[model samples]
Target: MLAPKRSWIQQVVYLIGMYGQFLKVYVKTLVEYRADTLIAVIAGIVAQGSTLIFLTVIFNRIPTLAGWDFYELVFMFGLAATGRALNQTFFNAPFLLTGYIRNGRMDMMMVRPVGVLFQAIGYSQELNGVGQLITGFAIMGYSASHLDMAWTFLSVLYVGIALLCSAFIQFSILLTISVLTFWIQEVRSLIYPITWLYDFTRYPLQIFHPLLRGLLTYIIPYSLASFYPAAYLLRPEQYGWAVWGVPAAAMVIVMMAYFIWSQGLKRYSSVAG
Candidate 1:
């Protein structure tokens, strides 16, 4: 068949750009609720700080994880935490799938000209993500500085790519879970599992056996989201294999998730008003 025109790709880019406008509107609305946003930021700081303290406790007790020393582990934690936090900050719309479907808000969004997937993500920014982002950056910076290893320009580049890949991978998984709403009337039950899976993405899979680790890398792909990339960055000699797989898998998953979501759109039956 003749290839479709370049129009489709352009439309997708246009859709993303439009979301930038919506982001501005979202920021305005958020600013209107200054107290709530402020409280959320402060609370997020405390919660995130507690998490770091817990990690410190664990690492202090354990000598090394999968032969990765403290600095290396910290690097892994930093990269994945930063990536996950950024994902939460930006593409948080998928989390609201339950309420949207239950209220038939899905029907209303489908009538719009823009991509409904993008539409579902409200134009407003997630202020709370900012706190997490700050925390993640702090940890990453601290870890990088304390390490005996020197990072060349290429290493820095790799870190940035790894971070982006991990975030995209996690978002793809979340997208896949949110689409499950169309299959089941209510899938709020799925949210806990989703969060649990995401939280589990922070560490090296080597903690588990080969078979179970394979399940994570293949079945749920938490490895692509965090574990593998973190390993590659932390212990390059040991996890050189995942340097490619981590980023490559994330890209592939994002594409596949997009395809799956498009399929779900076809199954959408607008609730008759």
Candidate 2:
């Protein structure tokens, strides 16, 4: 007889337990490479900081870009950074699936009792995420203090929901692209272009030409990751509907990614005999 299906809560608890074990293992490994972890975190901070400095220089030359002031732009950048940091921290290992596939490591994961995607995601940890997390929240805090929006319990709750949706969207995109390795077997270079697209999300969507704006919003939907949510937060009456799209788009992308990933698994061929 077939086993009973697990409830949603049971599934969530199982995932949490799996991730907790993964974290324990990751921490143990990280302790062995403390210097490397420190350097990685520092590098992340410097990289993100340089972007902020570049924005500062640009704002100094012009009061606003596409009608968004420095603080508003910072808020957008922070939202993108926070989403990216969450993906890099917890879901980035899937991007390395190409290496695993090429080396037959993926076969080992398939033989394990746990879910393959879960194992793949928990395969590694990134210390650089700590720096991005710090930088993202610092800019967000500074922007929040300066912005005219009224702070309320509901507003804070909205921010949390938006961030979660944004992070899911980012993770789904990364996973969908990474799953290409199941067929191509060498897609390491493809990740750069996908990540480069995210750079466009650091500014208001209005800055882009109409065609480019449409492409970002419809084709890749990068705008949903940060722009729409930031817009909603900055001016709820004006952009409240856009914020609702964030979770909707996130759900669609995640479902699509899962479909692709599941199909890709069927196409996977072991490199080992």
Candidate 3:
């Protein structure tokens, strides 16, 4: 006899349960190397904190960058950092797909009952991402309190939606780049340059050359993750359209990443073979 099919809600709950089990295993492993975990957390905090410090110095020297004040820039930086932190914490394992493919581990992953992406994420947890999350929210809270924008319930809702969508956008971009490993065979070198694109979202897009701005907005769409959302939040009258674009961009990028991953999966070859 055939088994009953699961409802969509049941499937989601089952997936969540699987992820929870993965998290428990990872935490057990993390506890075995407490010192290393502490060091990683500290390093993550310092790295993200230093960026805020550098921006503070820059703002002190110049009143504004393309008409955005220090607090406004901090808001943008915080949003970008928060999105990146979530990506690193949950989806960072995909970035190491090159190593997995080259080492024949992806073959093992493919044999698992669960989805390959979920298995990869479960195997590749970055505990230090907690530090980035802490720093990102601290800066975001401080900046939001200082900003002159009127605080309304809807405004809060908008920020919450924007942040969630931005995190998805960042994750999708990383996954799409990681998928290139299947064809390239070794793509570890591309990781840093791709991550460096986040720096563009830490400031007002207006400061960049028009062509570069177009690239960041269209080809890469990194600006949609932070800059556009920030613009919509701080000056809605001028950039309110971003309120719609942020979610749209997230959807488009995620679909694109999934398509790339599926295509790449067809090209995957086991290293052992």
Each candidate's TM vs. the true structure?
Answer: 0.86, 0.91, 0.90
Record all residue pairs in model 3 with backbone atoms less than 3 Å apart, i.e. clashing. none
Query: Which ranges in model 2 have alpha carbons more than 4 Å from their true place?
Result: 1-8, 29-32
Error of 1 at 100 (Å): 2.0
lDDT of 3 by residue, 1-273 (tens): 232478889878988998899889878867898887788778877987898899989978999889988999898888888877877777787677887877788888887666778778777777877778778888889899998889899988988888788777877887888888877766667867877888888888888899989988888888888888888888899997887878987898989888888898888877787
Q: lDDT for each of the candidates? A: 0.75, 0.82, 0.82
Model 2 has an lDDT value of: 0.82
Per-candidate count of clashing residue pairs (backbone under 3 Å): 1, 0, 0
The TM-score-based order of candidates, best leading, equals 2, 3, 1
All predictions: root-mean-square deviation over Cα? Answer: 3.6, 2.3, 2.4
Residue pairs whose backbone atoms clash in candidate 2: none
